[model samples]
Target: MTKNRHFEIFLATSPGLEDMLCAEVKLKGFRQPKAVPGGVTLRGGWPEVWRANLWIRGASRVLARIGQFRAEYLNQLEVRAKEVSWGELLRTDVPFRVEVSCSTSRIYHSGAAAERIAKAITETLGVPRSETADIIVRARIENNFCTLSLDTSGDLLHRRGHKEAVNRAPMRETMASLFLRKCGYNGQEPVLDPMCGSGTFVIEAAEVAARLNPGRSRHFAFEHFATFDPEAWEQMRAVKSQRAPEFHFYGSDRDAGAITMSRANAERAGVTAYTTFNQATVSDILPPAGPPGLVILNAPYGTRIGDKKKLSALYRALGQRMLEHFKGWRVGIITTETSLAHATGLPFLPTGAPIPHGGLKVFLFQTDILK
Candidate 1:
């Protein structure tokens, strides 16, 4: 593709996080970003695709719309698919996979449509099709219109190439980043996670404070494409706008194993210097010296097994601790139950939309700076 040509680049984010991801896109200087239901769409070429994968922390995947056509029958689908410049787009050395989904179209059989497209590509480009390939070509047939996109991010972006260990209460990095952004954290001050399972929140906050790119240590599927430029990608990725953080991010967990996992994950993420993980219970927490910032945590929803009463006591303890010691600090808690959040008894502001996490929908209940 030419440098001046603009393609439709879609950055996929979790549900209820579209607008927040759009704000990040605008801040990163992407052109004409519009937030939609499942993702945010913008206009750019290959470089924009690379930057979106490398820079955007909230996006789960970056999809580049490569082709679009109308196909009513399998014959028409094959013809249109052959017209696509697959050879120019993908290298013969790299095996690729095709995924198809159909809705309200004459080509109702998804398997048939996929096989047609796969056969066309194999015949034309002679590239092997693998059931599991890092390079993915996705097609959505909706209302007789087919739109093809490259899943430039093969693995989900949340696997940030660090964090070899995690606790039972695990949170994906992408969701953690959005929740932190929703809490009005702009990397200006300190952050703490009392129930910091695997240290997702604390480490994300520390990375933001240091101006580190989340995708720095990972490999994306886009690197395997024929259009990838090694020199250009290296130079762009090498440009680090790192800022030394003034305050250390804090995390405390009752589980000693959780604390150890948090420390190791921070070291792998290269944020150990900017973070401090303590083995402490909620009642034992003391606000760090120097400033009052944000205290955010993803608390247990008490979904599995029993003993929700004990969980309620845990929430009450957290609330009491925040009220008594964390004066002037804002608080954000994510939980699946409203009653549990209310049990915290912190004066919380109205919450945002519920975010789908695991099998449950969790809400972020935030409080104004404590009195």
Candidate 2:
């Protein structure tokens, strides 16, 4: 557990959410968090890497930048790669893989670079290399400088490992958490998703209210490293906060199957006690019996060639319902087009940069407390 030495820890996020991830990292007390292009960078060792994978909600993945060297030739790359302390980093019994990318460099063959690095590691650490291994070493050879980073997160952090059922175009939990933060939600007030697909928004809100760790149910890649301390990792993962929330999160959909999936997903996440799912349409949606809170949704806006005439009606109905029953609540709509958001006729503030969803660019349209 190198308690004294630290490495450059990078927390990856969606393209448009680097600053939000940085803020979350800083609030979690990681040392010197700075927002770079696609993620947040900090300084920490193995324990910090574990905590990052275990705690941060807005991050997509966590990476540990192990070592770097300037090598204009493949022989120099192999020699310097052999100098790295692979014995201290990787386990001899575990399998690993290498992936390399080269740009504007003398040693521009990515496959050759990967081969050299893999040979060096296999010879030095006696670890078997597999093409399908979960543990990976990523190399970026840009401007003739080779930068090495280890993917400490095996699976993407968005997968909380609890939800077995997901609806079409489902929103990821990591992105949902950041969207909630963008809507100024601190988990104090109730959250409702009228068109809740798989209960992602509601379940995430409930977990936040309970102060549950997003990564609690998932396994991280760092757990397989030679330097991993299972006892210390257990202690870190076991810390629970006392700030429990009392309000409930609500979700409703017109499809009975969606409601069923929502309930099951919430149950699997251990938040069913604080969540309520109902089957209803946009016209039938109603606010919960509590203080006015947030009415957020990822309504089904069709693809580029989708029927705009019908989607407009859906947006209008959602807007009408928000105005009728949720007078004091704020609203957030995640959609692909501005025209659909405009059809709602709600007074929206300036929108944020386009966020890359599954394959489409989605925008978050928010409003002030409704009049």
Candidate 3:
């Protein structure tokens, strides 16, 4: 019989991406996931955890909650920590680390709490609390209520195990996915990224449409857990058979080097058949051959140089081209600066999701029709 597992999963995301993360979780079948400031909390088993890690594009990491308790005092924390199911979750040989965050209600010292929890894991589970931990388990003490979670994905899933090549100010995969979802891309319509840098948007969209598992080619921290079932994980990974999609995913960059890197990244992602890379400027982009789809661009805002003389004209030209060519389609534009976005000259509204990228707050400007 299969175990009726009950575990907590935390979907880690950027500061402004919490709602989108929760929305993605719900879209992935989680009926009720509590949206916190930086992430979401849900209860489920290993299967749900695996699926979230595989399909959640906005999530950086998925952590499985293992324990929760209230400790008003350090002595109570020590006592409550002893009753946790450490033997079931950790092995004697595995190395682990404790990360603690504390708020009101008597847990005043976060470092002390983290040390106590690490000691408890070491004493009870026989697992050494090594600094170089294969897995990072998170502990949060809010109003003296403590919650423990184990990191399932060792690294951020947006790494995608591909993207060896990128150019100046390349957008992150997580943000790219969020913007695409905001555009309502269903993978059935043609998608184009005229300013594609390293093909992040196109590659991630292809992965989504083909039903490919984003974590298939990557490794996770949960694989090293004591309760990890290799056979079950293998079965889950077998679902990665979804390959090329029928919709066309076109990516173009003015730099020939970017186009070459896009093709290489696409091949590595195993979605080359569904993607096309070209060396073309945004002004040169023509309407796709198939039905009208979405056009997304993360143009240069010249944040560091503070030069707007040329980029302003670029934005105006971009808006002009979209108005002239992509008449019936939709467009999604992410910009670090509002003034540059205003120069687009397109009829658009704020997506209400302000995300952080490259240490700067960004917003998504979307228009269903280019007027």
Candidate 4:
């Protein structure tokens, strides 16, 4: 936490979309981004940390690696933890929380490890511990090596501070952005979502096309850190390079209420001018009049026996509509069951790994532009 010292920054994402997130981080100019299992990693100082929280769309949370050490025992762990320059990273006036996880090391009890680290922070930095604190210190002891990091993103990044309304099983904005990226959306092409619950995909696509920063309307936990520079952050957030999108994003759903929600959410997200929401069923869907684009939908994959039977027919109808009307449009369908995807008969290429979403494992089934 020394002044201007670079540290490892971890961008957390859904498990199956690490490569997509890594590509986004690399495009955003993060230094040497490397894709790991659950996320991406890079090295930078506090300014880069601030930028990541402010601009990156695919990351679910941002963690700043403050420091690490080898600790074989609790006493040694406590001593080393206390020696970390907590004052440089945390404010004594801010209440903070410590979370610890131990694996394959002598520190088997996570609670005891958390308590020891909490005690060290309380005694050395004079910071009060609070379970409800927004600032979080995370410690992981794996194979006798303890790495400490700060959760710079207090709430999950998907809470983009917009979209007050949502439908049942709506896709989060973080996951939606990554899915759009996986579908080869880069803001130039228009996007359409036939099952646009709450308009997540359409709104996210419009934001990308307009060059709007996902975190523009939200706040981050790093604002509470001792290293926070409000002046610098103000400048960073103010210098948005937004442009008017030439192509419009589109969405529709069978339910009238979902269309209302989509319009409201798009207006709240400041993309209403660039988006259009309509009330329609799968068979009623048609491509917009201008050009070929991407059609992505999070189709319903019901869990119950009767629900699955109903959803299969729904998927079949949707596929039939796409094949008949959406020629020249690429498609990305997200569903928990490949059987449902196959029911579309859309000639989907090799599917991506299944991603965990809303307690179900979902895969992205993509197709080439239909002839």
Better of 3 and 4 by lDDT: 4
Name the regions of candidate 3 deviating beyond 4 angstroms: 1-3, 240-243, 304-306, 351-353
Candidate 3 structure quality by residue, lDDT tens digits, 1-371: 12356766788888877877788889878859988988998988877887788777888899887878888888888778878888877778888998889888698888888888888878887888887887887888998899888888888888878668887788888878877887888677788888888899899889888977677778888788777888988887786568567788999988899899999999998889989999988789898787788899787787833487778888888888899999888998888777888898988875575677877878888897654
Clash count of each predicted structure = 0, 0, 0, 0
The C-alpha RMSD of each candidate to the native structure, in angstroms, is: 1.4, 1.7, 2.3, 1.2
* Model 4: lDDT of residue 139: 95
Scored against the true structure, residue 55 in model 3 reaches a CA lDDT of 73
Off by over 4 Å in 1: 1-4, 304-306
**In model 1, what lDDT does residue 73 have?**
92
Question: lDDT of each prediction vs. the true structure?
Answer: 0.91, 0.90, 0.82, 0.92
For model 4, what is the error of residue 25's alpha carbon versus the real structure, in angstroms, after optimal superposition? 0.6
lDDT of 1 by residue, 217-316 (tens): 9999989998889999999999989989988899999889999999999999999999999999999999999899999999987783236677898899
> Candidate 3: deviation at residue 43, Å?
2.0
Which pairs clash in the backbone of model 3? none
Better of 1 and 4 by lDDT: 4
Better of 2 and 3 by TM-score: 2
- Supply the global lDDT for candidate 4: 0.92
Check candidate 1 and list the clashing pairs.
none
Sorting all predicted structures by TM-score, with the top scorer first, yields: 4, 1, 2, 3
> Could you arrange the candidates by lDDT from highest to lowest?
4, 1, 2, 3
Which structure among the candidates has the greatest lDDT? 4
TM-score, one value per model: 0.97, 0.96, 0.93, 0.98
lDDT of 3 at 160: 79
